[model samples]
Target: MTNLALLGARLLIGALLIGGAVQKALSPGDAGGMLVGLGLPFALVWPALIYDALAGLALWLGVAVRPVALSAAAYCALTSFFHLNVFQATGDAWQMTIFVKNWAIAGGCLALMVAGSGAWALRADRP
Candidate 1:
């Protein structure tokens, strides 16, 4: 049961990252605009989009899962830091909720970084 839960968590995280990357890659212009609105540099946005896509693919393939997990954890850390100020200023419950959610997701990413994807990985058969 524990193994199943871990596998489920891994798949869910992998799927979310892949889907997010696809969204950003397919609509980079829009993603870039959002990044700009977030006050990040335009140059950073394109590179970040590429990193997200590649990392997502890596995670999905279970090729170098640890590295991919670390990358995802770092990305989530940056996101959490960026939103820390928003978390402080929010009077609305929804905003506060999302801020907490981001932190929780960051925690989950960190856990994946430490726990790894285990034996059911796509790269398991590789020598």
Candidate 2:
């Protein structure tokens, strides 16, 4: 049951990440505009898209889980810093809420990192 739960969680998180990456990659111009609004370099938007897409793939495939989790955690932390600190300074409560939400997701990723992909992963033969 616990393993099933873990696999379910992994699937959910992987789906969300993949969906988000697809959306961003498909509309990088719009995402870039949003990133610009968030005070990030517009050039970074493309890299962010690539990172999201690859990370999502990694998570979905259960390959290089540790590195993927670490990268994702780092990305989430940076995003939270920007939204919570920089954007919140502009008095956007909603944005701050989103930032907190990202932090929560990051926490989940951290847990997955420590717990690994369980027995249902494609990379189960590894390690």
- In the range 7-78, model 2's lDDT, one tens digit per residue, is 776777777678777888787776677678777788987777778777887777777776677767777877
Give the C-alpha miss distance for residue 86 in model 1, angstroms.
6.2
Give the per-residue lDDT of model 1 (tens digit) for 1-127.
6446556767777776777668877877755654565687766656776777777776666667776777787777676544555445544565466556666766777787677766677774232
Give the TM-score (vs. native) of candidate 2: 0.83
For every model shown, what is its TM-score relative to the native structure?
0.72, 0.83
Highest lDDT scorer: 2
Instruction: Give candidate 2's root-mean-square deviation (CA, Å).
Output: 2.3
- The pairs that clash in candidate 1 are none
What's each prediction's clash count?
0, 0
Off by over 4 Å in 2: 125-127
**What's the lDDT for candidate 2?**
0.74
Best by TM-score: 2
lDDT of 1 at 4: 60
What's the CA error at residue 53 for candidate 1, in Å? 1.9
